[model samples]
Target: MTLPSLLKRALADLWNDLGTHMLTTVVIFLSALIFSFFSLIYFNLQNFVEHFGTELGLVIYLNKATPQDRIPALYQKLAGLEGVQAVVYISPDAAFKRLASYLKDEKDVLKGVDPKFLPPSFELRINRAVFHLDRLKRLAEKINRWPEVTKVQYGQEWLNKLKRFSVLLRAVVLISGLLLVLSSAFVVSNTIKLTVYAREQEMEILRLVGATNGFIQGPFLIEAFFQGLLGSGLALAFLYAGYRYVETLMGASCLLKGVNISFLPWTFIGIILFGSIFLCVSGTALAMRRFLRL
Candidate 1:
C-alpha cells in the first residue's frame, strides 16, 4: 500500500481505540518527560564542572622568612611547572587589600590587622589541557616541599567533593535512564499487543490472502510512530515550560544567584525525539513478532 493509505489505516485504527491510544501516549509522555528531566540536570552539572575546571588553580603561600628578592625566581620556577599556564605573585600588602575587598562593609574587622603578617603568595593558573586532580595534587606536593613555600592549597576538599558528585550523578542518570527506557518500551509493547490481538482475525485473513508481513505490519508501525511523535513532543513542551518556571523562580533568589541553568540544547532535544520514536517503533515490532509469529 501507499504511504498515505498506510497512514490513513493507522489513524483509523487509533481512532477506533482512541481511549487506549491516548492512555498509551500519556504513559509514554510521562516516561519521556522524566528521562529528559534527568538528562537536563546531568547536562547542566557537567557544564558547571567543566567551567569550574577552567577556573581551577593553585595558591602557594610563601614563608615569612622568604626574601622579597627571591619572589621573582620563585615565580619563574612555578611558571615553568607542567600544567602551569601563568604565575602571579601577590605581595602581603596586595593580599591584605584583597581580603579587605572581600570583607567590604566588614572591613572594620581588619582595622587592627597588619599587612606585614600576611604571607606573600603565588597564584598559579592551570592549563585546561592538563587539568586533573591527581596532577594538581602532585604539583601541590612538589611545591609544598620548596624551602620558601609555607603552604599549597587548591581547594582539594571541594574539588574532590565536586568530582565525586559528578560521578555519582552520572551513574544515577545512566542507570535510571536505562530502567526508564526499558519500562517505556515494555509498556508500549504491551499496549500494541492489545491492538494486535484485537485485529488478529483480520491480520490472519490478510495473511491467507498472501499479504506480506511488511504490508501487515506497516499500519501498526505507523500508529506507533504517531504515538511516539505526539508523546515526545508534548513531553518536551511540558519539560521546557517547567524549566522556564523554575529558572524564573530561581532567578529571584540567591539559590542559583551566579549560576545559569540552561535548558537542553537542540542536539539533545533532537536525540530525545528520535530515541522516543525509535523506542516506540521497536516496541511495536516486538509485539508484531510475538503475536503475528513473524
Candidate 2:
C-alpha cells in the first residue's frame, strides 16, 4: 500500500477502536510513570549514600594543653603521610566559634554554655583510593600516642551496612520496576488483542482478498502504537503533577531537616520518555503478533 493510503487506513482504525486502544495505552503509560518515579528516587538515594560514605573517616581530638605553635607541625606531619589527602585544623577558638554559631539561633541557650569547653580537633580526610587502611590505622595510633592527643576516632560500623543497603535498595527498585512494567505490558497486550478480535472477521476477509501483510496489519499496529504513546504521555503528565504537588506540600516539613534532595535531572526525564516508548513498542508488537495470526 502507498504511504498515504496506509496512514489513512491507520487513522480510521484508531478512530473506530478508540475506546479499547485508549485503555491499553493508558495502562502502559501508568506503568512507565510509576517505574520512572521510583527509579529516579533510587538513583538519588544512591547518590546520598556515596556522599555519606565519602565523608566517613577519623576525627582526632587534641589534648587541652596542646600548644598553638605545635598545631601546624602536627598538621604537616599528618598531611605528609602516605594515606592522608589533607588536614583541616580546628583550634579551640575555632571549635568554640563553630559551636557558638550553631547555637546562635537560640540566644538564651547560647549565653549559658562556654564555647572554650570544646576541644581542638583535626578533621582528617584520607585518600582512600591510595591510602592503605592498615597504614592509616597505624598513623592514627601514632597520633593518639602523643600526650597532647586526647583520642582518635576511626572506623564506622555503619559503612558496610550503608553500602550493602544501598546495593540492595537499587536491586529491589530495579527488579520491582521491571516486574511491574512487564505486568503493564501484559495488560496492554491483552487489551489490544481483544480489540483486534472484535474485528477478526474483517481481518480474515482482508486476508482472503489478498491484502499484503503490511497492508492488512499495518492499521492495527498503528492503532496499538498510538494507544501506547497516548497512554505513556498521559502517565508522564500525571507523574509531573504529583511530583510538583508533593514538593509544594512538604517542602518545609520537619522530617527533612538535613536533606536537600531535588527531583530527577533532565537526563533522567529523557530516559523516562525513551523507556516509555520502548514499553509501548514491545506491548504493541506482542499484541499484534497474536492478532496477526488470528
Candidate 3:
C-alpha cells in the first residue's frame, strides 16, 4: 500500500477503537502535563535563586571611632579584594538617617539616641565568577582582620540551605517525571497491545499475503504517533488553562516579585511534546516486537 493508504488505514483503525484510543491519549496527556509543570517550576526556581544570590554577601562594620580619612582607604582596599564585585560605603550618619526614617512615626523614641550608635559599614557584593562557599568564608576571615573593621557577617547558613533546597527540588522533579513517563508508557503499551490482539487474524492474513513486517507495522506506528500528538496538544491546552487559573488565584501578592510564573518557554514546550511522542512510539514499538512473528 502507498503511504497515503497506510495513513488512511491507521486513521480508520484508531477511530474504530475510539474508546481505547481516547483512554490511552488521556493517560499520555496527564503524564505530559505533569512533567512539563514540574519542569517549569524547576527552571523558574533556578532563575529566581540566581537573581536572589546577588543579595547574599558580607556586611563589614567599621569601629565607631574609625576616622573619616581612613574610611576611604579601607573602602578602596575592600573594593580591590579578589572576588569582590563592588563595595558600598554606608556612613554612620547615613545609617542613622535610615533608622530614623524607619521609625519616622515615633520621633520621640529617637530623641535621646545618638547617631554614633550606628557604625559605618561596607556592603560587599561578591563576583558571580567566584561565588563559592569556600571563597566566601576565606574572604570573611580576611575582612575581620582589618584594623578599621569591627565585625563581619555573611548569611552562610541561609545560603547553604538555599543551595541544598534547590538541589533537592531538582532531584524530586527528575524522579517524579521519570515515574510519570513510565506509568503512562505502560498504559499506552497495554492499550496498543490489546488493539493489536483484536486484529490478530487480519494481521495474520496480511502476513500470509506477502505483506512485509514494516508494511503491517506502518499503520500501527502511524496510529500511535497521532495518539501521541493529540495527547500532547490536549496537555498543553490544559496546562495553559491551569496556568491562567493559578495566576488569577495568586492575585497581586505573589512574593516572587518580578519573576514570571507562567507557562514554560517555547523551547521547553517543544521538548515536552517531542518527549511525549517519543515515549508513545517507543511503547508501541516494544509491544509490536513480540507480536510481529504473527
Candidate 4:
C-alpha cells in the first residue's frame, strides 16, 4: 500500500482504539510530572554552586590599623594566589557604611556604636573547580598566619554540610527520574500489546489475502507513533502549566530566580517523545511476532 493509504488506515485504527490509547496518555503525564520535579531540584543545586564561585562569603578581615597603601599589595597578592578568582578590598569605612545601611532602620540602636566596630575586610572569590573545603580552609589559614590578617572565614562547617546534602539529594533525584521513565515505557508497551491483541483477526484476514507482513504491520506502526506524539504533546502542555504555577508561588525566592524552570528542555522533550514511540513500536512488533505465524 502507498504511504498515504497506510497512514489513513492507521488513523482509523487509532480512533477505534482510543480507549486503549488513553492509558499511554496517562503514562506520559506521569512521566512529565516526574521530570518537572527533578529538573527544578537540579537547577537550584547548580545556582548555589555559582553563588559560591563569585559571591562567596569567604571574608578575610584585616586589623583595624592596617594602612591604606598596604591594602593594594594584599589585594594583588590574593588575586594572584593559586586558586583565587578575584579579591575585593572593602575598607573599614565602606564596611561600616554597609553595616549602617543594612541596619538603616535601627539608627537609634547605633547611636554610640563606632564604625570602628566593623573590621576592614577583603572578600575572596575563587574558581569553583578548586573549592574543596580542605584546600580552601588551608589557604585561609596560611593568610591568617600573617600578622596583618586578623581572621579568615568561609562558613566553615555550614559549607561542608550544604555540599554534602546537595550531593545526596541530587543522587536521589537522578535515580527517581530514571525509575519513572522506565516505568512509563513499560506501561506504554503493555498498552500497545493489548491493542495488537485486539486487532489480531483483522491482521490475519489481510495476511490470508496475500498481504505482506509489512502491509499487515504498517498501520499498527503508524497508530503507535500517533499515540506517542499525542501523549507527549499533552505531557508538555501539562508540565509547562505546572512550571508557571510554581514560578508564581516562588517568585520571592531565589530558588526559581534566574533559573529557567519552564518545561523540560527540548532535548529532554525529544527524548520522551521518541522514547514513547519506540516503546510502542517495539511492543507492537514483539506482540505480532507470536501471532504472525497464523
Candidate 5:
C-alpha cells in the first residue's frame, strides 16, 4: 500500500476505538501528573538542603578580656588563612543584641545578665571548593590554641547528619520515581492490550497478506502517541490549577517569613510530558509484541 493509504488505514482503525483510547489516555495522564508532583517536591527539598549545607561554617569566639586594638590584626590573620573566604567580626554589643532577638519571648531573662559578659566573635566562611571536614577540624584546633581565642565552634556533627539526610533523600526520590514509572507503564500496557486484542482478527489478516509487523502495529502506536500527548496536556492544566489554588492559600505566609514556595519549573513540565509520551509508546510496543506473535 502507498504511504497515504497506510496512514489512512491507521487513522481509521484508531478512530474505531475512541472510547478505549481515551480511557487509556486519561490513565496515562494521571500517572504523569503524580510523577511530576513528586518531582516538584524533590527539587524544592534539594534546594533547601543545598542552601543549608553551603551556609554551614565555623564561629570563632575571642576572649572577653581581649583588647580592641588586637582585633584588626586577628581579623587580618584570619582573612589570610588558607581555605578561609571571609571573616566577619561581631562586636559584644551586636552579639548581645542578637541574643536578645533570639530570646525575645523571655525578655525578663536578659535583665539578669550584663552585656559586658558577651564576648566578641568572628563568623568564618570557608571556600566551598576546599571545604573538608578533617581539614576544618584541624584548623579549628589550631585556632583554639591562640592566646586571644576563647573557642572555635562549628556544628560538625549536625552537618554530617544533614549531608547524610540529603543523600538519603536523593536515594528515596530515585527509588520512588523508578517504581512510579514501572507501575504507570504496566497500567498503560494493560489498557493498550485491550485495544490490540479487539483488533486481533484484523492484525491476523494483515499478517497473512504479507504485511510487516510494523505495518500492522503502526495504527496502535499512533493512537498511543496521541493518547500520551492529550493526557499530558490535560494533566498539566489540572496541575496548574491545583498549584494556583495552593499558592493563594500559602504564598503570603511563606513570603512574610522570607521564604519562597515555588512550583515545578517549565523544563520539568516538559520532561513529564515527553516522559508520558515515551511511556505510552513503550507500553503499546510491549502489548503489540505479545499479540502479534503470529
Candidate 6:
C-alpha cells in the first residue's frame, strides 16, 4: 500500500476510536513526562557537579611573619607543582577588600578591621584531570608543612560528600530509568494489543483476501506513530511549563541565589522524541505479531 493510503486509513481508524487512542496517548505522555523529569534532575546534578569541579582549588594562607620577598618564589613553586594549573597571589590588601565586599551589606562589622590583620594567600587552580580527593589531600598536606604557610584549605569534607552523592545519584538514575522503560513498554504493548484486538475482524477479512502482513500492519503502525509523536510532544510541552513555573517561583528565593537551572538540551530532547516513537511502534509491532501469528 502507498504511504498516503496508509496514513489516510490510520487517520480514519484514529477518528473512529478517538477515545481509546486518547487514553493510549495519555499513557505515553505520562510515561514520557516521568522519565523526562528524572532525566532533567540528573542533567542538572551533572552540570552542578562539573561546575563545582571547575571551581575547586586550594587556598594557601601565608604566616603573618612570612617574608614579603618570599611571595614570588612561593608563587613559582606552587605553579610548578604537579596538577597545579595556575597560582595567583592574593595580597593582604586584596584579601581584605574581597572580605569587605562580601560583607558590604554589614559594613559596621568591618568598621575596626585592618588589612594588616588579613594574611596574604596563594590561590591554586588545580588541573581537573587530577582533582581527586586523595591527590588534593596530599598536596594540601605538603603545603601545610611549609614554614611560610599558615594553613591550606581545600574543603575536603565537602568534596568527599559531593563525590558520594554523585555516585548514588547516577546509580539511582540508571536503575529507575531501566524500570521506567520496561514498565512503559509493557503498558503500551498491552494497550496496543487491545487496539489490535478491536480490529481483529477487519484483519481477518484482509488475510482471507490474501493481504500481505505488511499491508495489513501498515495503517496500524502509522497510527501508533501519530500517537507517539503527539503524546511525546505534548509531554515535553507540559514538562517545560512546569519547569518554568518552578524556576520562576525559585528565582527570587535566597536558597537558589547563585544557582542556574536549565532545560533539557537538544540532544536529550531528540532522544526522548525518538525513543517515544520507537517504543510505540515496537509495541504495536509486538501486538500485531501475537495476533497475526507472524
Query: Candidates' TM-scores?
Result: 0.87, 0.70, 0.84, 0.79, 0.74, 0.82
lDDT of 1: 0.87
Q: What is the lDDT of residue 196 in candidate 5?
A: 85
**Candidate 2 overall lDDT versus native:** 0.72
Runs of candidate 5 exceeding 4 Å displacement: 1-14, 53-58, 65-70, 77-86, 97-114, 124-168, 208-212, 254-257, 265-267, 290-294
Q: Residue-wise lDDT of candidate 2 within 250-294, one digit each (tens)?
A: 677788645555677778767666666666666666655754663
Best by lDDT: 1
Please rank every candidate by lDDT, starting with the best. 1, 6, 3, 5, 4, 2
Q: Give each model's whole-structure lDDT.
A: 0.87, 0.72, 0.83, 0.76, 0.80, 0.86
Candidate 2: C-alpha RMSD to true structure equals 5.3
Residue 117 lDDT, candidate 3, scale 0-100: 84
48-155 per-residue lDDT for model 1 (tens digits): 765576576899999988988998899889989988998889999999999999999999999988877799999999988778877888989999999999899998
lDDT of 3 at 264: 82
Which has the higher TM-score value, candidate number 2 or candidate number 6? 6
Residue-wise C-alpha lDDT for candidate 3, range 1-294, written one tens digit per residue = 799999998999888899988888999888888887888778767755655565668899998888899988898899899989999998888898888899889866888888768999999998876677667878899889988888898887776777788789899889999899889888888998888788888888888999989888999899888888889888888888988887776676567445556568899888888888887788888887866885
Query: What TM-score does model 6 achieve against the real structure?
Result: 0.82
Clashes of each: 0, 0, 0, 0, 0, 0
lDDT of 5 by residue, 1-294 (tens): 456776777678768877888788878777777777776667766665444444767899999999999999999999999989988999998999998999889867989688877899999998877776667778889899999998898887776676677677777777877887898788888888888888888788988998888788777777777888889888888877887877677756755344445778889888888888888888889888976777
Q: Which wins on lDDT, candidate 3 or candidate 4?
A: 3
* Candidate RMSDs in order: 2.6, 5.3, 3.0, 3.8, 4.3, 3.5
Q: 188 in model 1: Cα distance from truth in Å?
A: 1.6
Number of the candidate with higher lDDT, 1 or 6:
1
Q: Any idea how many clashes model 6 has?
A: 0
Any residue pairs clashing in model 1, and if so which?
Answer: none
Name the runs in model 2 displaced over 4 angstroms.
Answer: 50-58, 63-70, 73-87, 100-118, 124-165, 250-259, 265-267, 290-294
